[model samples]
Target chain A: MYQLLNHQRKEKLRSPFWTKNILMNILLGFLGLYLIVTALVVSFMAAGFIREEFEGRDVIEVFTAFLFYFFIFDLGFRFLLQQLPALSLQPYLTLPVRKSKLIHYPLLRSISSFFNILPVILVLPFFIMIVCANQTGLYSTIWIATVFSVIITNNFLNFILKKYFVKRPVLILAIFLVAGCLLYFDSIGNAPLSGYFAAAVNAIANLPFLFMIPLIIAALTYYFAYHLLRKNFYPEDSQTTRSRPESYSFLNKYGELGELIGIELKMILRNKRPMSVLIFSILFLAYGFILYDDPDNHFNLMLGGFIMTAAFAVNYGQFLFSWEGSYFDSFMVNRVSSFNYIKTKYILIAFSGFMTFVITLPYAFISYRIGFVNAAMLLFNIGISSVLLLLFSTRNSTSIVLEKSQFLNYQGTGAMQFLMIIPLLGIPLITYIVFLILGIQQYAVFALGAVGFVGIIFYRPLLQIVVNSFVKRKYVMSSNFRKK
Target chain B: MIELNNLKKVYGTKTALSVGQIIIPERDFTGLVGNNGAGKTTMLSLILDLIRPHSGAVTSKGKIVPETDEWKNYTGSYLNEGFLIPFLTPFEFLAFIGSLHGKNSSDVKDFLNKNRDFYTENIDSSKYIRELSAGNKNKIGILAAMLPEPEILILDEPFSNLDPRSQSWLKMKLKSLHLEGVTILISSHDLKHVTEICTRIILLEEGIIIKDTKTSPDTLVELESYFSVQV
Candidate 1:
């Protein structure tokens, strides 16, 4: 298995002229360094949670809540990026590979996944903080519990995920939604369960047989995941059964562009992967409203939500190049108007921007009663923000070539992404800060409108210029997007 | 008719295609042949104007090729599933493509009814493209491209992800389409099938056109050489 993985990596790096792909590699390398630095900062923070006084606060509660949500995020991304693509192997049964062995190797290789280490990295610090701050004697039993914590947690995460993918994706998503509400109510947000786990940790550290409990749970979770694995080993049998009627065939409600958007939206709704991103977008949009009790922070709330729209568009739009994945050759040879192709993406982002505003609009209007002015402001901001985003997106699309969504690869790591951030939020943030500096509290609404007005005036011509540049830069864009 | 004038494209520090001037004969079913890095894809991309030529120009019909959308009315293609919207069913996808060519929704449905066997898998008719396999996804893409019934059709690796029986069925369908005067250009590594179907075959090597053989009984030996991949 190790050899096989090594071979795969070598092959990935084998393009002879990839030596010229150095700029991309350096960008990827910097992103790696950033993640490591972030990890260290988190570890230091977790170490502080070791203090005894921290226990009385919501430290453990917050930790568990975030950890559980992280587990959901992990599970959602895994089902999409990893398990979803592995599904293609089902049609390859006639290619002479042993089905059981092929499934076994992928599953076995899955155990060493890159993501499994993140929770452990993030969680261990809090446990350590709980230990060292109390100055508890380094009892071997307490140490044993930590090891059990890793196993039981990892096993449960895997089992929940494996079981989810085994079913139809939508049904799995439904199960996830129901489970989330229950978990929030029954555990994380519930004082009893949080206290139980916290106190259980303290008692377990105090008891002689406390080590045995986690071991038992760990064993059971492991067994459950393994059993699920065996059942899914023969995916070919499930292929024909996985069929469903075409649910997204709405002839109305779309232009050629709009229909494309509708169909794309439907896939996102039905699949757990893209749906997770959308769900988070909705939550954050609403939560922006809920974040402050102070009425004055409303402006900040709108700005924060607007900022998030820029971020989501950039992150989501990166996939457009790869969305075509392997079919790029067809796009290359077909009679698709490059102008229309680029316009479709612009329209998609614009639609998302609209959605972001519409979702947050109710929150803004009901609370502020700013009325039609606010609605118009939102529409304008959305248009400007989406246009700016696509402008940045066009540049990024040129540089970042997406392959099939890799299982563990989250960030695509291009200098253009870095470049996007500087403009995506920076200009707006600077403008907002300047507004504050200018004693402009009364003019915040007018200022946002002014920005929107400017975006409207120049965005189309800017878009035309950008699309023309995109045509001229197609070589650069295609090659860059296609790079390692 | 499509004309290529010294059409060529090269990536930074490496050449991918350098096809000297050549014209695709009017109404010919042509097959493209090459190795993994051969210029087959690059040549096709140039013709469609998806990418600009590093050097030359391509013209379709009497116009200067795709300088306008005029040729699109006469062209339809399926390069792969990426050209497809995953959330759309085969029926919906076909309908949308048909509308692009100014057909009614019923016209699109009529096309699918005649070609339903093209999507005969038991997979959910109601599900989205994200739910389909690569092969099944390809099937929808092929259906969408053909529904428009354009004068020119282009396909890349069309027979991939298909069972042998399905492959035989598709070949027969292509034969009929060709008989009806649809000019087809296919890029594939499947030599035997290409030889059996195409009236012309262009062999590319290392981004250079080494052979542009029109299919005739006398060219059987050249076809054999390509089948065996002997330069």
Candidate 2:
């Protein structure tokens, strides 16, 4: 087993994927640290509430609510890993391993992996701070609850995600939505599902029932997932096709790269996995509108449009390298230039960004656009920013790790996003702010153009630098691409 | 004719190839036999100008340095993943390669028509290259190299993934091409196939040519002893 694992990597280590993996992991570790720090900062900012409300709030309530939120978010991530039905669980089904033991392995693996650890580190301390502030004898109860919550959430989420793949995603989403509503809606004020757990904690104020939910969810999800792991469970099985002799005429229209890129395009649309992230990004856009809830604020309106546009581009553009997974080596041998490859990706970004623009146009029109000047400015920003995002993403491609697994999983994003911190949110801010300061908000449109034009020219040099980096680091990128 | 003069290569500090001097006469089928990391690929890459040598250069035809246009126009080569476009259908991949060799996609298909079974497979060319099986992928790569009908052909581990039937079919094809005076260079570790088909053999050890022989291995025992191995 170990040899097979190492052997798969042997060929790849010589490929570019290996170096990319190392660089990405280092970047990922740092990014996790940054996120934890950021989360800590945010929680710290909210600490004033804990100090003020310490006496009325039973600190145990805070613990329960924390676990509840963890459960809610983690359930999504776990499912995406298909942890419930992943290759990681293959041995348990037949190796005389107990089903419970087999299922627990993933739970254990999850706990050991950094994603869970980072969150635990970020949130648990806050829970402890709340507990200490209360001086309530609730230490043991909270610790147990925390452990239970992590395990159960991880397990349950894995199982549901596997189940989601086993079923269709749309169906699974509908199920989760309905279940989430039914489970907690009727008992909102009383906090029905969580209320009982809250009550248990209140009774002992110091009792640790936090761990129970995760434990139950983990055990139950495992029981069903393992039971369902029948003879080489392929989450991708339903998508597989039996070999058949077929015509090549369908390739005609694509010209040269067309059939290839077209087939790849079809693969992406069919996967529907990334669509989940697309939905999430859209939700994030809606949240932006919420941040600028005041409709009368013109500056806020423009700010919202820029963000909506930027998110529309970057969110979709991030997965560019991954979409070419496994077949990327083929790209090197083919005659397609790196320019065309990157150009095609930019086209995809533009297409998707256009959709987002079209979808949100009424919103933009309602808020501010009354003339072609406004409309054209918005269009230019959308087109230009999307192109710039692809250029930056080309550099980041060396750092991104796209896992060829059941969709909706963590894509091994790195501190690569830090590069975006200044550009994505920054430039738009500076331009809009400067324009507002100058009392000429309209001129900001030209600034957007200038920034974009520089980006276009800069992409050429960036392309040279990055493509050369890619050639130098080709072996590393290819290897890591295959590993995950 | 293909010529190698004091060709050398190094991976970091490790020597990969160090052929002192050799000449591949026109119209000869040469089999390059070596183990994994035995520098077969390095030798082939140097000859193709895919990688430049540290000490010596390979000249194709009569040129000291191969002009990329003329050299590429008349040569068809495939090694590992260097022959495929993963996003393309096998048909698309073949067409793309065919185009590079100044042949249209339809011309490529027409060329393969005489070898229909060879070109035919239980894979949809409309499907992406990533979707094809290894054996079928080999079929596409082989076809891409062959469709151009180049004056020279270089293949690496060409039969590794092919089924026995496909292997036999390819062996016959190689024999036919050799008779047409097309020079062929094949790199592989399979001694039986190499000795059976090659007009001449070059055995490599530690990146240097250890043995070059013209003996016909008409019998199994003679073949084993030729490489100085006790079987």
Candidate 3:
């Protein structure tokens, strides 16, 4: 299994897409290192704050009391970021290898996962500086063992949770609802749960044998994952049943472009990657509250407006062409005109932006200016940002696998996708800044709106250019989409 | 009729296909037979306008395919799995294709009923194309192409992933469709199947057509011997 996994990794690294952009990799590497360092500094500072907060109380006990919250974040992060272990395990399924070994390969490979490294980075510095320096060898050992146990339990727990999510998504929602109820009782209903949790963590140091509890939890989680993988190893079991017609047929009434938009909507809602992006965009709509809470943070208001309205454009439009990469050839040979095809995409993004602006309308109560600024930004996003996104999207010929994890999984992203950020976010901001420096601060909003309005006015001619580009690149796009 | 006038396609340094002055007469059931990378798929792609030829053009009914949308009104094609939309149900996919050619859901349902044997258990089951078996997915692709009642149908390697029963069913369907005077082009590596169903056979070798002949009773034997010697 190790040999097979190593061979897979080597082959993946050798793929042209992976090695094509050296600059992106280096930038990503530096960004990762910077984040890790920032996390370490933040954790150390948090440790110091804990020391100051509890002057007489045992720092370890106080830390243990807060461990519950840490695990909450850990579990949530693990669920989102952890890559499923068996993505490349399909080829090995038909081989003579044991099923148990095949399943264990991904589980074991996950031990070295970045999810595991992150918690250790946040926890280790404090453990060494505070727990080790202040406690006996036995106390430190038990404390350290407790942390590792929770981390391991969280890891395997994710495996079980994700297995359930794949098999039955409702189970995950039910589990979360139950967890929410428990939190309510502990924090607001004066239940014994919080006391019990702190007791459990502190007992690890007071009674070293209590460390066995977490280990048992980890083992049980691992066992559950093993059974789940064993039961669902075959290809037949993996292909989920479609159950019923989840597509919306009502949109068919709007004629061909409407039907095309309906198909795009179904693609977003049914697929894993696009669905996640849709959910994330909805979640981002609440950012207006965060940014508009303070009037002094007006820059955040403008940025939020731009990002919020163009949320789908930034997230989904980056891979606009690649999203349909699998079936791009069918589009080429079909009777659909390039003009209507590109126009459907335009309506999808612009409609989403318009909807976001409407959703963020209640933020107007903060001040009328806030509402005006956001409206201008929304217009700019729909008119200018979406056009830029579509134009840049034409250059993207990379075929994206819709099944892959969307979080931090940069598969189809190229240098062109990276450059898409320039026009989407950078150009508007630069325009605003230049307008502000010109001493007509109030005109900045109107300037951005004017640019976007100009785009909207010339929508026909602009759409023609985009349509021509798409038609011109059909062959190039088709060939690129065909590549693995 | 479809005409390829000096159609040439190159991928970087390699010339994938370079066919000159080939006219596929209307109502001809032409089979494209070639080894892997022999430009069978590439040629089909060019004819369908899925990829552009570096030089020359493909004209269908006196209009260039890329310049005019008129060819799309009469053409139906399925080159491979790349042409299948995996997110959609088989019914939805076929219905979508039918809608493109001005057929409604009832028309699509009637079309499915006509070729029900090709799909067997898969047609009634509500499963996404991605969840279905490879053979079933291929069935969806072929059915989608046939659903439009097109005048020109192009299929590449239709028998590659199909079960024996499905393969035979498709052969019968193709023969029936051919009898209805629909111009059909098929590419396959299986010489026996090609010779059995196709009225005309074109053998491609190294991106160029080597043999273009009308099929006879001895065509299968001739193709077998030719491949055996080439190997």
Candidate 4:
């Protein structure tokens, strides 16, 4: 166990991504610090915010009523972001280590997940502010313990949920449906689930020994995960059922370019990580509802337009070449031209932007301003952002494992992805702000569209530039990819 | 033909591979045999331009492999599973490779039919390449390499995971390809298969070619004695 723990530390420290790139490490460290500080501030302010929103009500009771909502949201958050703790067990499978120890290593190591830490950061402060001040020491202590027990229970429950959900994706929709039904029922006053939930939690404080119920629940969840993991410890045993081969012969008309796009589409659809990224991007289309409802916030509207249109390009194109890192050698040795390879990526990202823009056209029914802004942003994204993203992608040498979950999997991210986002999103917003300052804000949208129009006209030459960069960096990227 | 001129690859202070002036002529069936760290794979990677050497160059058919991609048109090689796309099924992967070589689906079907002996039943299944067994994956890779019918063919450890029958079938298939005037370069730890199928054998030790000779009946015995003495 000690050796396993030590190996885990070395595994992280020796990750070529971190060890070779000190700048990336520092950037990631700062980003992590920023997130923790933000969460802490939010938690500190949460009690007062709740009190203000629900005036004339008992603050403790109100907060306690919402604890059930918080746990459900935490579960969903973890389901999306938390990675199954992996130790590359293939090598260890053949070693002399005990099977139980091997299984326990990852399970125990998962307790240290940022998902686990986040709840503590976002809940502990509120609990201290509200429960500690209003109740006796013993009561508050047991109350906090009950909440933490559920939190730890959530950590284990997520493992089982993710494992099963991967095998049966319908379970994901079912879970959402169940949660939605609960919310609906609670809102219509058909069932006072939140009130009962708060009473149960209050009971733990009133009778401190009842905290054992949550503790036992946490223990049971841990045992369930252990049992499931032990049963399918071998790699082969955990293999999902084979996917049927889907035909894309309709794409044959465009010849090589269409074939390439078909393969790329299949890659995104079939793989876990890329598919999740696509779904996440599609979800951003709803941003218009939030931003467009308020007419005065034109800047927010532009931001929303940019996000909705370029979400796929920014998210997926950030790791453009890295997507094929697994089969990079085949590409090098095969007869596929680097120019065409890059052009295919450009076409896909641009098409995604167009498709998103069309889907969001319905927003124009609400207001024509929403339509004009999204249209300009869409053109900018497909023209400028797409080309710029593909150009910057040539500098990305980190190889992403497409099979892994995307939530916190920072496998292929580098300084280039982060730096590129500044200009890709910033240029349009900066152009808008400049126009607003010049007192000609209405024409700013057209100016942005004109710039993108020029980019669209010269796309062939721009793509050539990206291809040149890719050809120059091919050897470096290939070598880095082979490291894994 | 492929030519290696003063090829040298260095990993830190150690010279992983260094070869000077070796020409692999057309239709020459060359086998590279060596110990674990003998730099066999490294040399192949350099020949394919998968890695850039510290000094010197590899030229295929008069064009430098790194400077021009013309060589990729007539060269087919599979160094490892990295050459196979995991999400693609066997048929899709073969078709993709064929398309790169300007072959349509009909052409791919023809190629599959021609190599029916080596094409296993698993290739017809709908499973992705990642789901297939190691031997089946190796077969798909080998078949894809040969699908384009290039002048040059290269494989690394092609016989490792294959069963005995499949191994012999591949040996026969490779021998037939050599007979059809395809230049072949393969590295294998199995001395018997290499000696039987390859017309020439090159023995590498510690980044240097210690022996280069035409393979005769006694070549396997010589290799066995050399390896046993080292052990």
Candidate 5:
């Protein structure tokens, strides 16, 4: 087991994904630390906030009532973000290690996931501040133990759910249905399901012996995962099913560039990683609902419009050439010209931005300001931001494995993507803010549109610049991509 | 015609390929033979403009490959599986490759039909290129390279992963293409096949060309004796 763990450590350390770019690793590390600190701060503040919000109710009761909702959210978050612990166990299978130990290796390794730590950070400070401050040490200890066990249970259950039910829509639909019903009942204020959960947790806190219930539940979930995995432990059983071949013959009429774009669209739809990015972009279309609720905040309105229209372009375009890294050699050697290649990517990304803009145009009904801002941002995203993203992508040489899940898979990420965030968001926000300072915020929005219109006019020259950069870097990009 | 002028490539401290000059004339069947790490792939990569040389250039028809995209119009090369898009099926991959060279789907279909004996399975099946066996993948890659009826064809170890029957079929196909005046450049470890088909052979050792000669009846014996000494 120790040897297996050591091998895993070496595997991670030696993976070219991390060893290639120490800067990206450092950036990710800082981002992770920032999130942890933010979670801790939120946890500490929650106690006082709960007391103030529910003035007449018991503080512990309000906190415990919300615990159920938090757990559901945690489960959903894990479903989206938590990567299943996979080790290259075929070699170990032939070795002297026991089969159970081999199974336990991955399961045990999963406990160290950041998802497991996040809940503890979120709950620890709040629990200590509220429950421990008022109650006896024994009572608070039991309460904390119960919450920790629930968290562990959630961690293990998430593995099972993701392993077996992720591809099956029925289980996911059932979970969503139950969550929706609970939320609906709670909103209507009739026998709220959260009230019962809070009462149950309070009862368990008062009775220290009942802490064993959550502990047992956690143990059962772990054992259940173990048994399921042990039953179907062969590596062949874990292979992803082959995707059906798709034809885009209709795109032929649009010429070679259309076919290229069709190929990219197929790549995104058929691959797991790019599909996840597409899903996230679609979800970001709802940004107006959150940011536009406060109609007067023009800064957020501009930010929201930019994000909503350019979500796909920004998320998917950052790793534009990297997506085709696998076949870049073939692409280069073939009759495809670098200029046409760049144009294909530009058209695809900008077209996606245009589609998103039209889809989100209904946000105008909320307010004419929103409509105007979205229109301006849409032009900016397609004309300026998309061009900038394509330019920056030439510097990214990291190759991405399309088959892997996008969640926490940083295969194609480089420092360029992190640096790109500043200019991608900064330009619009800064331009809007400068206009607001001059006391003509409306014209500032109009100015954003004007800049984008100018960019659109000179898009041919901008595309040529991108193509030139790609041409100069093609050898390096092709050689780097060929490494894996 | 392809010309390499003082072409050199280095990886870290080791020079992977260095050639003062080697001009491959039009309609010539040229073979590159070497051991592992002898830089056969590197030389081909430089010629394809797939890798930038240290301080030299490859010019086809007096046009620098890196400086211009004209060579790609008539040149087709596949060095490895990196040339194959794994997500697309063999037919789709061929069609895409064909489309790039102004060939329509029917043209691609005709090419596949002509090479029907080379494929052991259904070429138009839904199986993605990645899911195919190594030999089938190689076949798809080779077929895609030839689909454009390119004037210049470059392949690295085209016979390595092929089955025995497919290998002979490919040999015949190459001979036919050579007869039709298509310029062929291939690198292989199989001396028997290389000597049998190639009119000219270049032996590389440690990034330097050791022998460049036209194939005669005794050339196979001479090459075999040379390799036997390395043991």
Candidate 6:
């Protein structure tokens, strides 16, 4: 089993999907490492805060008391991001490999997950502090063992949780709502869950034999996961997998381009990655509360203006042409002209920017400056940023698998996408900054709006340029999309 | 009519397609034949403007394929699964295709009814094109191209995944369309069907056209003997 995993890793590294654009891969790798190290440093800092708050009490008891919340937080995150055991186990199921051993492979693999190690990384230093503080070795050791057992228990519980929730997604929402209600009750002191947790932690430390509870829980969870995997490992029966017809006809009322937009909308709603991005774009509307709450910060307001107006554009536009990667060839050979195709994208995103602008009007009620700046930014994003994104999208040929979760997957992301962000967001922000430094700070907003209006006025010429570029790269894009 | 003038396409060091000069006249039932890697699909792609040639051009009715959208108004083609919008149902797909050529949903329904025999199963019940079996998916593609009643039709391996009954239905459909002077081009490895329906057959080997001739009664026997020698 270890050899099989090792071979899969090596084969994955050899695939062009991983090895392409070596420099970009190295940069993203470094960025990831930087984030992890920063998180570790933050955890180290948090350990000090814990000691200061819980002074005069045994640090082991306080830290152990907090361990339950940590496990809950980690569980929520792992549910969202931790990949299912997607490795093809079907091939081994046919072999002489024992079902017990096959199930154990994924269980063992789950323990090595980055998510399992993250909590350990955060809490390990706190335990070391307790050891340094001259606590009883046996008591400290029991606390440490209990925390690790809790982490392991959560890890195995995740496998069962995900397997069940995948078949019934509404159950996932219900579980989250229940967890939220528990936390709410505990917060309002209606339920003293925290006090109960602290008492349990003290019991585990004082009576070292009580550590057996979490150990038993961990063992049972692992057993449950094993049985679940064994029973549900094969493909679902055809009856359960049959798909019902789903139709969307709202956009058909607008004629042919409306039909195209309707398809695009359906694609976004139906696919996992696009749906997540769409949701994220909506959530980003709340960013203005953080940025514009203080009216004096012009810099933050400008930055917020860019992000708010262009939220949908950035999230949806980055994968503009690639979003249609699945059926791009069909579009190319169909009756749709290259110009009309580019025009349709421009109108769709421009309209999205307009809608985002309208939804953001409430921000203006908070502060007139935020309101006016956002209005200006909305114009700029629709006219300039959206056009730039559409033009750059003509160059994107990577075929993205729409089924996979988008968060941190980065499966179809390429160097060009990263580079395109500069022109899409950078130029407009730079134009605003340039005008601001020249003592025309108030006029800067209008300048940005004017530039955008100019872009809209000459939309035909701009679309022609995009159309030509799309035609030039059409063959390469089609061939690349065909690769997967 | 489609004309390929000094057309060439290469991927790195290998030539995928190279046609010095070729003309497929209007109303001709032409069949393209080749083994794997023989550039049959590549040639069809170049003609349909799915790929850009390294040199020269393909023109349909005196309009360059890439430079003008005029050819698309009359051209209906299905090269592979890439030409399908897999998320849409067959009914939606046919409707969308019909709309592109000024046909309404009723027109598409009429077309479906006209060619019900070509679809071996009830396609309207399927949720999406992706859920249908391979044979059904091919039926969707072939019928979609034929929905517009195009002046020019190109299909790559139209008979590949179809059942025998569907294949005969398609052959009959294509024969009638050919009689009505709708130009048709088909690429297939099925020598029997190609010989039966196509007036002309072109054989390709390793990116080069080795034979282009009118089909006769003995065309299938001749092709088998020729391939037996080549192998």
TM-scores for every predicted model: 0.74, 0.70, 0.91, 0.88, 0.92, 0.90
Tens-digit lDDT track for model 4 on A271-316? Answer: 9889888866876676677778785577777787787788888889
* Per-chain TM-score of candidate 4, chain B: 0.97
Using DockQ as the measure, the top candidate is 3
**Candidate 1 chain A worst ten-residue window by lDDT:** A398-407
Candidate 5 lDDT over B1-231, as tens digits, reads 999999999999999999999999999999999999999999998889888999889999899998888999898888899999888888888989988888888998888888899986887687778778899999888998888888999999999989999999999999999999999999999999999999999999999999999999998999999889642
What lDDT would each prediction earn against the true structure?
0.62, 0.61, 0.81, 0.86, 0.86, 0.80
Clash count for each candidate, listed in order shown: 18, 23, 0, 0, 0, 0
Model 2 TM-score on chain A: 0.62
Chain B superposition TM-score per model:
0.92, 0.92, 0.96, 0.97, 0.98, 0.96
In the range A1-484, model 3's lDDT, one tens digit per residue, is 6686886577668867567777778887898788689769966876678768868866666666566766876786677667667646678777898878887877777777777887788888888888888888998888888788888888988888776674444554566567767776776747756556667776777788777887888888888888888888886787665567776777888777877887888788778888767766766676676677776565676787786688777888998989999988778878887888998999898999888788777777877777788788877887888878888889999898897765666778778877889767788778768867886666676778877888898888988988888878877887889888
lDDT digits (tens) for residues A387-466 of candidate 6:
78988888888887776664566767887788998887677667767977896666776788888888888889988888
Clashing pairs in 6: none
State the lDDT at B57 in candidate 4: 95
- The worst-scoring run of ten residues by lDDT in candidate 3 chain A lies at A166-175
Candidate 4 Cα misplacement greater than 4 A, ranges: A1-55, A85-114, A121-133, A136-142, A167-196, A203-227, B11-13, B53-56, B113-116, B119-121, B217-231
- Model 5 reaches an interface RMSD of 1.8
lDDT score, candidate 6, position B138: 85
Give the per-residue lDDT digits (tens) of candidate 1, residues A1-484. Answer: 4654564456456744245556666765787567656765776675355345456564544454345455555655555444321434544557666666555555455555545555556556655665445545654346536444544456455555655544354566576677657666765456445455555555665675666776677666655665555566565444444345444456355555555455456555544345545544544554454453444664655455554344346556655554443334444444456666666777777667666656555554445633334454455555565566566655554322232232333344446656666765565566667778887744555666677777667766757865777566555555454443
The number of residue pairs in model 1 that clash at the backbone is: 18
- Please state the error at residue A138 of candidate 3 in Å: 2.1
- Candidates 1 and 4 compared by lDDT, better number: 4
Q: What DockQ results for candidate 2?
A: 0.25
Q: Candidate 2: what lDDT?
A: 0.61
